[model samples]
Target: MDAYDLHSGNGNNLSGYANAQIDGIISALAVSADPAERARLLAEAAPVLWDEMPTLPLYRQQRTLLMSTKMYAVSRNPTRWGAGWNMDRWALAR
Candidate 1:
């Protein structure tokens, strides 16, 4: 949200995107502690963000993981962590 906020500083908001409604939602989300309320806030914010389109994704990485069907316990770790991050827990069906 900082990236799209009106008063974001420290180079956090490069796009210079600003919207009052989103700003209020971002402020509320920042101090919110309740998980349900946070989720509700995010739910309320997503469509507004989409409609506003502060920034557009220019490219998307295409990832592929090939494994035998018997493979189990494979975890979808972040790209920086790599897919084998949880290799110890991986197993194969008999």
Candidate 2:
């Protein structure tokens, strides 16, 4: 809902093309049944976002994951909790 509000074309005239594409994507996603069609729509919008660059990065963060050779199940997420977040699902390699 937040995203829907963020790029809504209800009354605010933020920008033309970006607003239309963004709101279109968000609204369409609510009822989009075909995953492949969704992918195509997402792909269609990516370049427009790239051209606009809504978020300009200023810095970076670094993280490391350490695992033993025998431990085979680990997930690494740079943006969220790291490799141990889902330790409940981890298993040995055998």
Candidate 3:
């Protein structure tokens, strides 16, 4: 599929073109009931854009937060938000 990212305005995350090419295979994998068939189609579609991605992985940064004895509801992997983004569940130890 040919991916395009117009919103980023810098052209980073678009895969529409590549997506178009393998859309059938993706759709088949989605609706396929048989596990073997699903695996087969997934295997068939995974390599369509091998070594062709615009962006490459570099490194993973570890996030660490030291909270006091009262903090809670912290997410393990807060990709879209901060570690303590969900503060509704926070409580203090009496």
Q: Which prediction has the highest TM-score against the true structure?
A: 1
Model 1 per-residue lDDT at 66: 74
TM-score of each: 0.51, 0.47, 0.44
Deviation in Å, model 1, residue 48 alpha carbon:
0.9
- Decide which is better by lDDT, 1 or 2: 1
lDDT of 2 at 93: 86
Q: Model 2 — which ten-residue stretch has the worst lDDT?
A: 9-18
Residue pairs in clash, model 1: none
The Cα local distance difference test for each model comes to 0.73, 0.65, 0.55
State the TM-score for model 1: 0.51
lDDT of 2: 0.65
Sort every candidate by TM-score, greatest first.
Answer: 1, 2, 3
Give the deviation of candidate 3 from the true structure as CA RMSD. Answer: 6.4
Pairs in clash, predicted candidate 2: none
lDDT for residue 52 in candidate 2, whole number 0-100: 77
**What would you estimate as the lDDT of candidate 1?**
0.73
Clashes of each: 0, 0, 13
Q: Candidate 2's error at 11, in angstroms?
A: 20
Instruction: Quote model 2's TM-score.
Output: 0.47
lDDT of 1 at 13: 68
Best by lDDT: 1
Per-candidate RMSD vs. true structure? 5.6, 6.6, 6.4
